[model samples]
Target: MKKTLICGALLVFVQQMNLVQAQDWKPVEGKIMTEWTEKVTPENAHQEYPRPQMTRDNWVNLNGLWDYAIQAKGAAAPSNFEGEILVPFAVESALSGVGKTVGKDQELWYNTEFASPKKSIKDHVILHFGASDWETEVFVNGVSVGIHRGGYDPFEFDITSALKSGKSQVLQVRVWDPSDDGPQPRGKQVNNPSGIWYTPVTGIWQTVWMETVPSSYIAGIRNASDLESKQILVTPQVTAAQAGQQVKVSAWKDGNMLAEQTIDPNGTAKLTIANAEFWEPGNPVLYDLKVELISGKKVLDEVGSYAAIREIKMAPDAEGIQRMMLNGKFLFQYGPLDQGWWPDGLYTAPSEEALVFDIQKTQDMGFNMIRKHVKVEPARWYYACDKMGMLVWQDMPSGDMGNGWEMKVGVLGSQTDRARTPESEAIYRTEWKEIMDDFYSFPSIVVWVPFNEAWGQFKTKEITEWTENHDPSRLVNSASGGNFEMEGTKITGDIIDLHNYPDAKMPDPGIFGKENIIVLGEFGGLGLPVDGHVWQQKDNWGYQSFKNEEELLNRYAGLMKRLEELISDGLSAAVYTQTTDVEVETNGLMTYDRKVIKMKAAQLKPLHDKLYQVSVK
Candidate 1:
């Protein structure tokens, strides 16, 4: 009896151990990151300066750990919270410490506290969220400050009214994410993970913090570049103390102001950068801008910003095919489809090192561009892209219903998109506009992809024209791969786009004698899951799984070599299938945990470099 009882106890202990082990992050069978992720704490997660483009030396980072609780959709904030979960990592992510999931029927509560900035009264405290997934409500000191609906864009609320002077300020965030169940433009996240359906991200999945700016500040300013004219048009949206606000602009390089000028309210400020230091995949130079918001000579606020002077266009190749060119010179763009997810932080990186590492790795491999595929990262990520000399192709996340007939055809739907109801279009347009206005300042983004493979794509011709007219300097790809229709005019876009996979091949642009600029938008997903990095056991998968590392490398090399041949056949830019494995999708050069580099540089860099060197002439 004693022996039997001892065996039962051992069995129970083994089962308990298995339960705990299951909670630990492991690399998927076909993905890479068995080792890149590290344990995070309330004190030391994502401590980097979150906002890179607009930097003020005196801002506080509210990242690290926060209390979290899952409750019913309409339930009030929980009186008591569940244990601590890492901030900026979504509840659904393993890095979040909770590894919990919430849907439309549920809401997530986040609670935290911090001391106010010095003399925060004179310095108005602005509570900022790098981003919140789906719908969000914010409370300061238990008073509701504001609520936002978009999942990907950043939002801020003036929380000074809700704070107690000099005492530690408390913040509470409530979130509801529908994932694929609603029409909020969530990319890849699905309740039931499957092929291309990634794990869901709920609640605050980005940097959360507070900034103390004066009551009257440069609320926001937009600077757009004209590659053709070597100038950047500046539009400052200032919140001056009184009427008749004016802004003073000064240009600088390496810390010295080159020029200064003043512009009245609602007027355009043109800073003509002579022989502009252009931004391209090879060389990205940003000019420092200091703009002072003034009312009757009283300097209400001064904000520092920067913009690059560069242009991306398509011109006819020697073979009569059009090729992508930057600054009127033949330039080849090669990139990975940067998914922008981390094992410990999900939507947010564990630390600034993690953020810089991805860019560094991409640069080390010698690729000059990254396609921010179907997701908008925190401003810091794009700043890294700019600082690290990586060009960007930003895609608006794909959304809208999949019930359309064109869905079966697998691209953007057509004019008669009998599928698009009135309600679906409303949410899609509102969020798309916010996304455009939020990150418009970054100089690295040369192309704005309004749609991807036709997801919720409607009014393509109209939207493309508006996008081009709104920011005429950058190139635009109207439809990437599906519902492929151009705006019946030569002036609509600068490049012709096509999608390729497993084997690298482009579509045939028929003999219209039109200048066809070809680009292989996506290709190559050779997955090899390392032993220690994976999200889950049953769900993770890749487009093409390989038996071993050597096989994966050989296949990748073979695919890239074919990409080079396509470049000679008019391919100007090529985007690989992924940056890293996420959730159930194991097709990444690096594993999800980011510990392993699946393909060696000696084997892959030569091929990528060859793509950049392929002559369009």
Candidate 2:
């Protein structure tokens, strides 16, 4: 009787302890959090399909609670898990529910179980990760599948051979990230959070899912437009090609088939469009693509995609000054330096609606372009830009800070190139090429900014020439706001970019107008912080801060007036300081929480119209 009484008391005590722990669990509210923070839960976390470009209807989402543990680096997978963590969110993020920090010497381990979607020998279950930081290794049913190194690119492994014959399957992942300590493309992540640097995102920070495909399937596709030739290039890749296999590609507009062509599965197919419609800013026309792989008369696989017909080049304007021409016309591109970050979800956006909100808001503010500064976003973000007609100047995320940066303000100046280690150079080249390939399908991207302000700038001439040669479809800004290098006497890329603060300025027209298009790469950081929406009430800052919205608008108008004058002189494009308030930076038009818009969209629309209306002399 006494043993039974003691057991009952111990059970009651354990139940009470669990209740207390659950009550204590709350998001570590950053100084400011977004409205979406309140709505995020493990069941609904990033439920949307991740890969919009090459999508399949049948897939299983593995984003809910997962068993996680931090083990010493190089150690074997742990037998016991520390706790449950929300998948896809970083361990350091509040949304992750763990709120733990893993040092460089530690490895993050995630273990999850999923039921086999289709257990058949002919079907192959593919494991996909939208992105993960640094190094990652995957194991299925305790068998090693593959190892991937790059953090910012998507990777997958065919786990069919590793699966066991059972209803339940086991998945284990190991991740290690050194953040700023290592020489990789880490962007602005740091171990210690302060100033421009924020918290380091370790392990899986993107969607983790699985899809089942047949033995023979369509692997990938690359689409390019030839405006002058009036044809679209469609290159389809198949997993395994048969002797008489052919790939059929069709282009459709508004449910009407515009063109269709078939070619060898290994070759490039050209779909000719008579009197093709050129895609522009307001009317972002897209042609739907349907690709099917067939052997003899049997259809093996099919995939749905989309593309836009456009061209970006450098051509002389009326005054013999080089200008950035989009579809054979000079359209001045002006927008914000959009550093895609969120207060609640770092690296990953909280939700799909939250992901595209910035692009829509920027368009409403009368901007036509955006400089995706120093970071790459999910494919869905680029898809929104493609559908909404927001032209992007994608930047290769900056890293390897070992470079000796020389900031030059003149048109002709000497530049300092970094002596990168062979390993560092290889890492940079591999990641940059992967990023370019991953984002190539999105037509909204018109410019590729490889280096920003000499951050990891090396082999300037060689890298620039390589980028131009690889994708002659888009113009290459070898280094936006970077040290302009000269190949003998000429700039390497198509644009001469300059970064000026608070006031509008451009590269000297007299010096670079003849060879390259002159552009004000960055300017106008007019800041007005809302009372409750700041990262910190006391230490918030901007390039030029104001007390009220009226003053902020007035300062912005002044900058626009100066920008109009620069455009008349020879400026082809300009980028504002930022899109949103990041950390302690209060330079965004909107607040950090996205709860308040400091500048009215209605107020700035006409001012922007006036700048676009100015005709070059």
Candidate 3:
């Protein structure tokens, strides 16, 4: 968007919030106990453009306060507004301004109006959403424009025809989320909030925005790099007359045109660039992509996109021990366990700064990667990792926990003993496919973990083969931890995985084999709860608790020191538990609210740096 449009949006938000007028705009009482949360506001909360990989200059940010109502699940839209609720913040979250619950059979409604600057015939309006949990029906000017069903990926609707002749317009959304009660992939949510599951998120928990685009625009684009060929395969989605249509892809760096080509739109187009910059941990390089969909002699549409030339895989070493490989070279991965939670926003972090802060802090702490646990994040979060050059192990959210479910059940040294039923298995596949499709674009994502410790483990052989066939370029993780499926369990397609809790241990290669890359999937969950920053008042817990920061730091240091020895002894990757404090889990390097970084980043980062050096060797 132009600076003027940005200023207009900011002005609207600032005026609406009217921080000076406390009576009109105040948070729902008893929900938020911290004064620091006031910092998360409309103008500042997650203001960054949500989709960084695919860039558009004229997109609007529709975060902040919107009118919300809770109604019967199948009820029609309400004629009147109820009260204000924050966009992107889950209904159960403190920052939502509603702090309410939408049960198994309820619809959460949102209504808002927005104004856009005038544009010419060459321009069109594009309505965008970061994501909507469960099913969503969107309307503009009282006309139903579109309906989106998935809870994970992003979707956009062209609303230029639905726009008003005037300067402003109204957008209404009706959302239905059955959460875990239905057979969708809802990770760790329940009707009842307890132990590991604390509260369920309903409705829009991601950003909503609008943008102006050309009538003939680039609908979508894909950048799949071929390290072996030293080129990138660009596929731009456009409005084409027939199946054999060809689109032109233009590449640029720092606004300087480098190469151009027209190729078949059926699959990826090979664009050769001699020794083009490859993105790695330190010097990450990204090239801008511009594609024009052509029909006869006229340009039908054009879109702006970007991609980096890089690769993430796992390979065996000289001794034939499996390890993580970046660009075909063994690079041991070390990272924190990113739970992807927020004290205020739940799945959605309150601010973009907070999202990037977690990544940057992870890098600062000396880790080169992150095991993004069970939850998929907004695109911009991955963009930050790309920019920062941190590897990511993406986990498919654990869908079903079977009959016995606890929010904080102790399973530290114990084994996970849950299996997915046939019905739940189908739902798991549906959600897993959606999750993979959403995050497959990111270059930072190195591995796809389908099952984690058998939380929803079923048909592992089928899921692994499907994942491997889906994205043959990247590696597939058969299962993260327990209920070990023996089909592809021994032959590691990506990383030979093993789980360790207090003391790190590798899976016996005699049984699981020295066939592929090996990694210590999880370890080092040292918990220390800071008094003011905890999610719960009393029962907040971790794998282990500490009374002071000194003890916490000491234990963490010892854990890393042991990991350093393990790294040399065939441990290709390790993930600590976790980035920060979750609802009841206190085992995080930082506190849940993100107000406190319990350990010094300078001390932690060096530990990871050494591991990366080992991998490079």
Q: What is the TM-score of each candidate against the true structure?
A: 0.87, 0.94, 0.88
| Maximum-TM-score candidate | 2
lDDT of 3 by residue, 542-614 (tens): 7777888888877877876777677666777788888887777788888777777888887677655665665
lDDT of 2 by residue, 254-302 (tens): 8999999889988887888876888879989888899988887887778
TM-score of 2: 0.94
Q: Model 2, residue 229: displacement in angstroms?
A: 3.0
lDDT at 96 for candidate 3? 80
- How displaced is residue 311 in candidate 2, in Å? 0.7
Off by over 4 Å in 3: 1-23, 29-36, 116-125, 159-168, 212-216, 240-246, 264-267, 294-300, 403-427, 487-493, 613-617
Q: Rank the candidates by TM-score, best first.
A: 2, 3, 1
Clashing pairs in 2: none
**Candidate with better lDDT, 1 vs 3:** 1
Tens-place lDDT per residue, model 1, 1-617, is 99999999998997776455344523222233323354455556667767665666667888766778998989878989986777777887666667777877988998878876675447687888888988899998899999898888988998878988665888888888888888778877788876776778898888887777886776677877776677777888755445677888877888877767789756667888766688876677888888888877687777777877877776776667676778888778888898887655667776677877888888877788889988998888888777767889998888764634343233222444325667777777777788888888887887888877767777766777777777676788776655555445242355556665677766553431155566778777767776667676665687789878988888888887887787776677888888788877788888777777887666678878887777656
**Best first by lDDT, ranked:** 2, 1, 3
The candidate 3 region of ten consecutive residues with least summed lDDT is 405-414
True lDDT of residue 448, candidate 3? 90
